[model samples]
Target: MQNKLLGVIDATTHKNGIEDLITNRSMSAIPFAGRYRLIDFVLSSMVNSGIESVAVFHGFQNRSLMDHLGSGREWDLNRKRDGLFFFPSPLKEPDSDQLGSFKQFKQNIDYFYRSDSQYALISNCHTVCNMDFESILQRHISTHSDITEIKHDGQSLEMYIIETSLLIDLVQNEETTGYRSIVDVVRDSRNTYKVSEYEYIGYAALINTIEKYYKYSLEIISPQIWKQLFLKDRPIYTKVKDEPPTRYNKGAVVKNSMIANGCVIEGHVENCILFRGVKIGKGTVVRNSVIMQKSQIGENCELDAVILDKDVKIENGVTIKGTETIPHVLRKGTIQGALMNS
Candidate 1:
């Protein structure tokens, strides 16, 4: 029998809204390792697993997302039966603006249950990695887990410790001890006859659980409830692969660091997280900067920590450095200082 899987793309705010202020954009839309946006990883993974139906939950500041993923044809997700679907937050009134991330997510849950699919794969765009959901779904079936979470072990403690603590406190009672790490909380949350190893990759596999507990309940639920439902017993299993850890392209020379994509380089590059389609002019010495999509740098122009927004241009001999700690936000054009949206 063919199993229906839904890939839910969570295009939420970035860490406490810091990145959002700069770009006023969704994390999914954030420019990453050259030539690939953050949402590309999740969307590509779904396509790789033969999942054609996807619903991307887009909230605030999604114009760029709409522009980049127009019709979803590039990823082969544009189809009549199973293709990419955009689920934006419902407006309170006809004239009202978009809702927050959590509000949009709750609406997505409603959309998932209304569908004819059996399983749903909920993912956030913050993570960057490769995943095979077909294999993961098979494991979930064999284990009969109501909810399965995808997890990674190597994340820094400082990054995940507080979130893990909050999860434990919300899901478990006061008597629950030894909740030192996220692993401990996962171990305690299982409601099955036997425990299994399942890494919580901050992603989840829900089998009709959204309908059972959440349908007709409320438009929005607490994070605690979300965590409790996520931890529900069944047979949570982790699909760990010994693949080579992701690395930057060799030909691409990054001087100041912050390179993300699997980019291939043929020319010299310095100090930039060159988001995909960023072509460097030969002998271009880009110092301390972020260059967004398809921006071309002229040869010998020195850029220091400059935030070049989408489709920006820099003429040769243009030196923009030491403006401020925060890089100058340059929209489309050959800019020298800051270009604020007016």
Candidate 2:
């Protein structure tokens, strides 16, 4: 099922507000579910769909991306030919106007020219879903489309499967038009290029805003969504971690939560997602929240609709509450909680 396919994860753009939760990491590297990054969905979807080659364009804090993807072996992308490639942007550019996304593509035009794949699947690490791109590839071939992209509710997911030659032609023809981004090209291509759109039902969360992020993080609580995301045909792969099973002490109580490995729970957790290495001290009560890796929550604390970023420390007897619509967020590595004694 090669279909002469090549994948390009065009995730170099910045997503505002997500920086508030994590300052030193790219959005693609932000952990999701229990143990996966946002990029894991896109990369896994592609790899599960039989893509052998992928190129990730890094925007800022690329070190985080490098740390997560390492050798691409987790996704089975380490190959002698047509594996993974990293394209890094300079720390400082001459001007903002010169940093157009199309300009970035023009700089890396040799990659597309050098590849023998007939089709280029351009995607972003936004939508979190398990999907197979094979049907869309077949659709593109059957329709003889210059570009075939997926759309949900009349919105393109920024994942386009276009003919490689058409992409090269677009790059060559739109060199100096001050093109803003690839979306601009596709938006205007209806007139110049043959374009086809397929409806996609893969939107479990529109995570551009904090509210959406919080909302979608809890969507996994649903039996339908959980089965669709994890128990489906293709497995979502990520960097493996060797840790013992989550330990729930005699007094610990868990209800409707997804807790990962390396967690020690001695309190009560309800409707939450806990990443690895989290330690919930005795007598704490947490509800409707997402606590990331290595965070420590002291005893007698009460939290509702909160998102504690990785490595956060919450002291005892403190209370933090926010609505599910707009959950309170603690940035990465921030320490919260009152230094109080019972």
Candidate 3:
């Protein structure tokens, strides 16, 4: 079954609602769950499903995505055989930035043509789930369906399993057929293809907007939610950073937070998720926030319901607060000081 299936991940779509966090990175590379990127969940699922050859199609803002998925070593896809392949879209402006984009796929049609796989598992990079594509493939085969769309609670997860030949055919004749993407083909009533849906009962979160991102990030703080996403046998893989254990200094009071490695906490943190190498200075109080990698919060500062990007520095006595619905977002490399706020 592994030899008969190929993995294709679409990482090019950009959401206007998520613009704040994606200013310097693609949606797929957005930091999540303390140490992993949004793409890690889907990519790891493909690898865990025994799909050896995987291709990631990305857009212009691909520096961070490329850097994070360099050779796909962390996912054990760095091999001499048919391993991880990356294809950047040639279009400076695509006709449409949708999942299973045929425009981008048309740019690298040779990849689909040359593969020996019988079927393809196409997925979006931003969906957070620990899925087994093999199960979907089995159902597709048993049902004799042309396209199998995976859904969670009757909502589309934007994942599909289709024959490789049919996928190539759709990409090749997209203009003639007037089909922009897999969604278009599936929606068309004139098509003879048998479309099916496989209900996914597991925990799945699609991080497409700021609200959903913030909601899911905090939701995973619960052990029950994180347990569903991170399985013992099928673990999500990410670029490993060798960092020392997190240190909780004297006077630090943390409750219900998830802190990654190489962190130094001397402040009070409650219901926050701190990524790798974050520093909470003495006398600070942080609550219900998602702080990314290497961000430093200064002494006596207070942050609530905020999302700080990587390398953000909150200076002494800075007080920033926002609601859960519209959390304050500090872009990457930005420094917020008390004087700035005053």
Candidate 4:
């Protein structure tokens, strides 16, 4: 089933609720869990499931997304033959609400026709889970279904498994069928397609909003949930960064925080996740926050329930606080000085 299945990742969805972080990037490129992007979970899962010849369909403002997935080398997908393929759509305004947009798929329909895979696994980019697609494919074949949608806890995870030929037909006759996407074909009962469900009882979270992102980001700090998402066998792959070990200077106090490499810490931190190359100055207290790559916090600042994007610098003596329901988001490359304290 591995070699017979093709992987399709839709990276064009743009969520209004996550606008602060994704204004300059795709939702898939958003940083998560200290060192991984949001797309890492799903992409790595596909690789682990032995699915080669994956294609990513992205939209504009895909610089970071393309950069993160360069040559797909990190995922062992930089093959000479059937490897990673990227398709950049020309549309500016996308149907951000839906998972599988047939219009976007139709733009690059030739790729589907050229591939020799018998089945195609279509997925959205925002879901975080360590799934095994081979198992799903086995079930789809056994049931003789036209389309199989993956569900978790009775809710759709926006993932589907369908035959490559059928998907191509749907894309070609979308106008005549009046079906906008694979989602539409599943929702409307007029079609003769046999839609099946595969219930997945695992750690799955769909992050389309800042609230869900913040909630799930912090929730993975628990050791139990961490183990479920990250397994030694099914490792989640990301762009490898060569950096020195984190440095905790004198008087640095940290508890229950996950800090990545190349970080210099001299502050009192608790319940925080700091990404690579971050710096926490002396006398600062950060609690229940997520600091992304290359961000620095000055001395004597107090941060709680906040998310600092990449390259952000917080000046000394600034205090910022947000409730768990609404996290304070500092955009990418922002420098928050004393004048901008809240």
The candidate that achieves the highest lDDT relative to the unseen native structure: 4
Locate the minimum summed-lDDT window of 10 residues in model 4: 89-98
After superposition, the stretches of candidate 3 with alpha carbons farther than 4 Å from their true spots are 94-97
Candidate 3 least-lDDT 10 residues:
89-98
Candidate 4 regions exceeding 4 Å error are: none
Q: What's each prediction's TM-score?
A: 0.56, 0.93, 0.97, 0.98
Model-by-model lDDT, in order?
A: 0.51, 0.80, 0.92, 0.93
Q: Write the per-residue lDDT of candidate 1 for residues 258-323, one digit (tens) a residue.
A: 443433343466545665556565555766566665676666666665667667767665667644
Q: How well does candidate 3 score on lDDT at residue 23?
A: 89
Clashes of 4: 0
lDDT of model number 1: 0.51
Clashing pairs in 3: none
CA shift of 284, model 3, Å? 0.7
- Residue 200 shift from truth in candidate 1, angstroms: 8.5
What lDDT tens digits, residue by residue, belong to model 2 across residues 69-116? 998999999889988898875434222222225566777889999999
Report the lDDT of model 2 for residue 338. Answer: 84
Estimate the TM-score for candidate 4: 0.98
Model 1 poorest 10 in a row by lDDT: 211-220
TM-score of model number 3: 0.97
Count of clashes, each model: 13, 0, 0, 0
RMSD of 1: 14.1
Ranking by lDDT: 4, 3, 2, 1
